[model samples]
Target: MTIRLRLAALCAAALVLTGCGAVITSPDQVTPEVYVEQPSVSPAAAKRFGDDKAEQAYQEVTKFALEQAFPEAFLDPAKKTYTAAELTAGVAPHLTPTAAQGWSSLVTLALAGDADAQDSLRILQFYNVDDPGSELPPDGDVLVRQQITDATVDVEEPSGDSPERLLVSFRHEAVLAYAEAGRPYELDVTKTMSYWLAPAGANAGSTWLIASYDGRMDVAVDS
Candidate 1:
């Protein structure tokens, strides 16, 4: 039988069971890839605002934001560590300065091993088998993949026959598998993310940049 691990209750459970009996180990010089399910515009959205160029831009921005926020994607697989500067610089092209600044504290906290912060960032991967009867623990490499679906873009502000600010939302699901280990385990996670985008300059045709972002972790059930 598979048990679902809820990150929301991790901290309190950490106190009771030695933090789920799983140690966060740094992997080798191999960056695990996240398989992203490409964003698809709903039929309703296409009918409402059929701007393919803007839709593609929104999708690119969303993908970038997701990758930067995901620890498995940003961490230096070679060194098994990451720097705030690297994170900031990587996101500079896609996110506004203010938005990048807002992510600083969260990134700092997650790197510092803050459980709550990691949960809030939707990057925590450690799992524990609460059942005492479970077999051995996983002891091999880590593999992670995330899928995006039901993506839709909404024109929040239409200024004088032009789309000004756009809101993009999508559902994110991830499966972190440790199949090669002793008693292999996997963590299935689901999250919803939203991004607010606007032109970087006053000109309506300027490059699009993410102005704000929000994410929420949904309850994950074992498959």
Candidate 2:
């Protein structure tokens, strides 16, 4: 059977055995690869707003803000908005107030499409995860830095064969290690994240969000 078929079967089996013993898949089991491509931004828009550098910065910041503010299961039922208070409460106990403020600032700038927003967002995205207490290198970076693994951009043509809509896919993986105070140990994890970006508002700016993420804990050792 095809990998996609196998994966679908696996998912169905998982649902069926929801309350039963653990479902198992062998190492040789096939898995399908997913790909998403990024669409090209209009040259006129790029020139009027800013260069590639500016756009990249904006995307980075927005991603950071969304990641920090929108934790798992924090979506408001009525409005479907991710509450800032819920985010602050969950992270505040573990991070310094300054750090929290930094995260908030990153999100704000990203929403505004500011150039400097990306750098700030990048920092927050690196650290906000299942484990936040990991110590970093001497420079205090928590995420493993790696090159882009997969990317694709999809452009849709309008009814009259005119290019009107665009979709960008970005995916990457990183190795991260960190240690915490009070605990005599260090932890390592490998994480992969992907996002999709599309034009936002009636203007040239773009809005993006997390499409998916897979995180796995590797090891914990005494520091």
Q: Please provide, for model 1 over 1-223, each residue's C-alpha lDDT reduced to its tens digit, 9 standing for 90 to 100.
A: 4333344312332221111112122333243344343456655546655678557765576556445544444322233455667545555556566555545665576679776755544432222222343332253233355555666776665668434556777776665543322456565667666776766766433367766555665544242
RMSD of 2: 16.5
Which of the numbered candidates is closest to the native, going by highest lDDT?
1
Candidate 1: where are CA atoms >4 Å away?
1-50, 69-82, 86-89, 108-120, 123-141, 158-164, 179-181, 201-206, 219-223
Span of ten consecutive residues with least summed lDDT in model 2: 1-10
Give the distance in Å from residue 100's predicted Cα in candidate 1 to where it truly belongs: 1.8
